[model samples]
Target: MEIATYILVPFILFALTGLKVMNEYERGVRFRLGNYSGVVNPGLRYIIPVIDTMQKVDLRVKAVDVPSQDAMTKDNVSVNVNAVLYYKISDAKNAIIEVEDFKFAVSQLAQTTMRDIVGETTLDRLLSERESVSLRIKELVDKASDPWGIKVNSVELKDILLPSDMKRVIAKEAEAEREKRAVIIKAEGETIASVNLSKAAKTLAGNKGALHLRTLQTLNDIASDQNNTIVLALPLEILESFRGKNK
Candidate 1:
């Protein structure tokens, strides 16, 4: 009885060691005698003890944050840029076979591709056309990583850091542009006001009594403020009219 108990214990241990349970998101790449075998789907899987090995890979979308890279723009501007990369493993077999480390490979590929795309783009376009540039980087990286079984979902430019001096220069240029527009608008307003004043003057001159009526209206406006005193100067036309009335 003691000998049978010892033997069964060893057999139970070996059987437990061969049993593997994979989650829903996991796939097991099985190798038999160091040769490519088949992929084990999510469930209880059995492997021969000391003969077959399995590597579990999670088939899930992953986000990798690329560190900031110092890049020079096409317009000769220096900037620091960072981005995020979204990717997934399309073919798990190729991912494990074609690359030593698929995640690291994709990350490095994204970094270099970002720098290359940034170098090709001017500073103005890089600042303005972020979506287009990100799509371009995604396409290039996706195409390059196809053999490695990585599908690049999307790429996003997160932040762009410019030099302090460049920021100040941009601020000053914007201020100057705003001032220029203000001056132009003020000049246009003045030109319109001058044209209107000239028309008013011509109308007042052609119509008799218009000037006197305007002067009376000004005096009435000034008199509306009870705290103010006004001096009225009668024009020569008023005196001539009075003289004609006396005659």
Candidate 2:
């Protein structure tokens, strides 16, 4: 009975101390007595009870929110902007060894990088240059975090918060631009119409019968408008011939 008790007690202790379970999306980093140790694969793992410590790291993509930062543009405009970062741990060993807190370091780095980018661009560029801005930010973040085994997949500017007065000014400026374009388009159409009319007039003047036909067409168009009042202008020679024929 005493032998049985000893065996059962040690079995229970081992089971409680050495057993570790890792999910499919997690990997465990094992260290022994302050020395570099290998990574533990996903599944059950056994460690020497107190001599080894394990860190469970998630392998899946992580989404981090970059808080709003007030940044001054190159044009001396102040804007508040916030962004999102999609990242993942690429090298588990380096991630464990290089940084004490990789996540916080990355977050801080992103903010500073964003500010730097904003400082280099004007407000118009910052607002209009989305693809370029995102690409630059992602490249910078990835380079900065490479030492920490962090891979920045993509960076996106989620929101740009501008002042109400700035919004109003921008809107007005946009409206003016649209109005200018409209005026230019209308003028172009009028020029085209004038050229077309001049060409038609020249063609009709070459044909003697075209003027009469065109005049008849104009009268027909006016009659089709369902109006009763009509005014006719006849040449003096034609009116005189008509009076002599009637007499």
Candidate 3:
């Protein structure tokens, strides 16, 4: 009876000690004596105390904010770029066996990819086509980290900082472009106005009495505003008739 009690108590203690609980979003990679065993999903898991070991990996997506890195664009313009990376472990077994630290590996890969891509892109493209740039970074990092069981969901460029002088130059360039467009538009408007005026003058001269009638209309519009004193002049055609009579 004493032997039975001693063995049963130790067995119960061993079973309890080997038990490990995992959350719903967690997975366990089990290794038996330095050998890869299998991945255990959420809920109650068990492993031998001395011979078996487990590493927990969170399956939930994690957001890692990459610090600003100094990079030079293809145009030889130096800029600082920073981004946010979203990733999660896809394979717990591979994540444990393949990489020393999956999270750190992902972050370092993201930073390296960002710098390389930024170096390849021009300043204008990096600023204007940020979405594409970020997507390319995500793709490169995802591909590179695939062996580590890391799944990169997305990468977003948080900011692109330029030098003060560069900012001023860009502002001046934009202002000049705006002014150029405005001048072109104004010139087009003036051209149209002059063309219409020429057509109207030709029409008035073609008709015999159109000029006199238009002159009277102008005087009428002026007279509508009683605040102004209008100086009325006789029509040139009327003066020409008087000269013809005298001749």
lDDT of 3 at 44: 84
Q: Report the C-alpha lDDT of model 1 over 1-247, residue by residue, as the tens digit.
A: 9999999999999979999999999888889999979888999989998899988888899999988999999999999999999998888788888899999999999999999999999998998899999999999999999998889999999999999999999899889999999999999999999999999999998886987789789888887887757576788578889999999
Q: Which segments of candidate 1 are over 4 A away from where they belong?
A: 184-220, 226-247
Best-first order by TM-score: 2, 3, 1
Question: What's the CA error at residue 49 for candidate 1, in Å?
Answer: 2.4
Residue-level lDDT for 207 in candidate 3: 83
Position 22, candidate 3: lDDT = 91
Candidate 3, pairs of clashing residues:
none
After superposition, candidate 2 runs with Cα above 4 Å error: 1-4, 226-229, 233-247
Query: What is the per-residue lDDT of model 3 for residues 217-236, given as tens digits with 9 covering 90 to 100?
Result: 88888888868585858878
TM-score attained by model 1: 0.77
Give Cα-based local distance difference scores for all models.
0.92, 0.90, 0.92
Model 2 lDDT per residue over 101-136, tens place: 999989999999999998888899889997688789
Query: For each predicted model, how many residue pairs clash, with residues at least 3 apart or on different chains?
Result: 0, 0, 0
Error of 1 at 223 (Å): 2.8
For each candidate, give its TM-score against the true structure: 0.77, 0.88, 0.83
Per-candidate RMSD vs. true structure?
4.5, 4.1, 3.2
